[model samples]
Target: MNAPYSRDCGPPPWAGSGGAPSPRPRRVPWLSTLLVAVLVLAGSGFAAKGQPDRERLDAYALALLLLGTALLLARNRWPVASLVGTVATALVYLGAGYPYGPVCTPTAVAAFTVVVAGGLRAALWIGGGFLAGHALIGHWLYQYLPPTGDPGVPWGREVVFAAWVAAVLTASELVRVRREAWARERLERAAAAKRRADQERLRIARELHDVLAHSISVINVQAGVGLALLDSDPEQARTALTTIKAASKEALGEVRQVLDSLRTPGDAPRSPAPGLDRLPELVEQAAGAGLNVTVETVGVRRPLPPGTDLAAFRIVQEGLTNVVRHSGSRVARVRIGYEAGRVVLRVDDDGPATGSDAGGSGNGLAGMRERAAALGGTIDASHRDDGGFRVRADLPAPVKETV
Candidate 1:
């Protein structure tokens, strides 16, 4: 149950006149309260029968039991108040010469509620004081306070009462600790789910950016060529239009694959992911866009991890796309290196700077970096001393163990 509000019914002091109404309070826990009341009253009546020397049961005794039950019903919303109320009623019942039975049950339940509601220190002080005061009344003051000529109780009974109080407090602390653990576990699960969603969003953005950027760059160059050659060189214009068609088709296919994966995640992909194995297609596409590309290999030839291959392909693709859009030179070179448990890729262009052209260099570069970083790799891109641009990436590519 939630915490209690003020006794009077009104909006809180902090709420504005036009603000939302206060949250509805939970109803008092009636069923459990009724059960405890029945048990306490019946058990005391039975004990009173055996303890004939004690003052007989009266209307005041029954009222005390009912009041204790009422206090317990409010325990969830007002634990401290419940603890104080129940403890006071129990003390009064015992001091009035009523025979003890399960009358302390309500106070014990309220004390447990207090500890679990983060009022441990308060429950300890009040509960401890109640036990001490009752012991004083029963052991020393009973001669003057109640049933006349009654003898003072033995010291052993006081020890037993102290033990009962200790047990209740101990049980409350254990339950409090368990509730806190469950609350922490729920929070951790929510945070983990949020993190997973964020990472998936980032991955989707990178995939869409890479697919659209490279393909659009090619289509842009081919369209310009087709427009220039349309009248004088009809055949060349036809070839340019053909390249545009091909580039657009490829972009659409890759985008469809991404969407299909999202629509039915964890299923086998209908098409293979693009990697260094598709380098020849990349080279031909660049040629269609009027930029010549060369591919070179060094060191041992071996298969790369799937993540490493994908990152390397995207890095080279972004690098050449940058060259076509920004560099004055039309020629680019790609170099692939296989070394000790790692693969390296480098793309270069020889150029005089062209400041007028604007492509998505920012998103392209950042996407490449993110892709490399996701696979525990790194990318570096900068201008060459020979007035050219170059992009280099180093990615881990440990060979899979053979069976």
Candidate 2:
């Protein structure tokens, strides 16, 4: 027989095997590459115009510019390596006295990429290296070389170049931090949604177990009685079969009500869930299954929270079902007591336990305890000293306010 509510609460559908989250796809660097290429081409053209040999562009200079642009293509995977290669190419191109404008373009883009990949600390180190290298090579060494008729190192231009590099590095770091923050927010939302779905599934499973277990246990007992009496007494067998049919029909309706609630939201009216008001019908069903049951109440009856009422009803129903199925007992008693701040329930049976249906893993008892605990209540179920089983539950009641 299939268990009513056995289901694996595995990961959400989007999750990978064993509930591990899939790795995020790597972002493409095409946008950055295109921007860098445009800057490199434009800077190279402007620098060539200022060249004394503008009519004849040096092949070596053109080759170095192409090399720097190619290095940027691998920036996403090998950021530090690409940064180093581009910076080195720019230094060599400047030392060759080809042009200065294009060299700064690659250096700036490479520094920005490093900042994006390695964050603020890396930007600081690379930016510092670029500043020191420019001071030593471009400013100091270029002043002594007189072949190109270079005027000299200008302090104003040097200061402006340092500021531009610093601005690019700072902007890259800010953008990287913002992107990381957005990714973290997305992950948090996904985790929260998964948690909600798991909780909902658990609630549905509990409801199904309580509803199906009680109804099916009674039906099984009635059907067994009908089969045995069909040989000896046709009249009693007909009564047992009728009881089985009624129990099965009611069980199907209740199951459909639960499923409908899951399928539709809003205020579509349906049959109300079983509560204390349905306890009489439950007792009649048990009596028809060959168990003599009695119910008694003490103190004034009061309305309860809908959840608490349903839980209390289920606990009682499960207790009676266990007595009929496992205790081999003919007589069962139930008592309800309303007190100052709580409601109490007790179910007891007179029995010599058959042990055929006893010694179960006690999933039914566990379900009862879970229900009680959910409403800030407690339940105790055990074999009585008088050779029977007893289940007692204490449920908290809301305090009344004086006007």
TM-score of each: 0.87, 0.79
How many pairs of residues collide in each model?
A: 0, 0
Please give the distance, in angstroms, between residue 133's alpha carbon in candidate 1 and its true position after superposition.
1.4
- Candidate 2, residue 288: lDDT: 80
Task: Give a tens-digit lDDT track for model 1, residues 171-242.
Answer: 778877986898799999999989988888887788888888888889999999999999999999999999
By lDDT, the best candidate is 1
TM-score (C-alpha) between model 1 and the true structure = 0.87
Winner by TM-score: 1
| Candidates in order: C-alpha RMSD to true structure | 8.8, 13.4
Q: Give the clashing residue pairs of candidate 1, or none.
A: none
C-alpha lDDT (0 to 100) for residue 317 of candidate 1: 85
Distance from true position, residue 386, model 1, in Å?
2.0
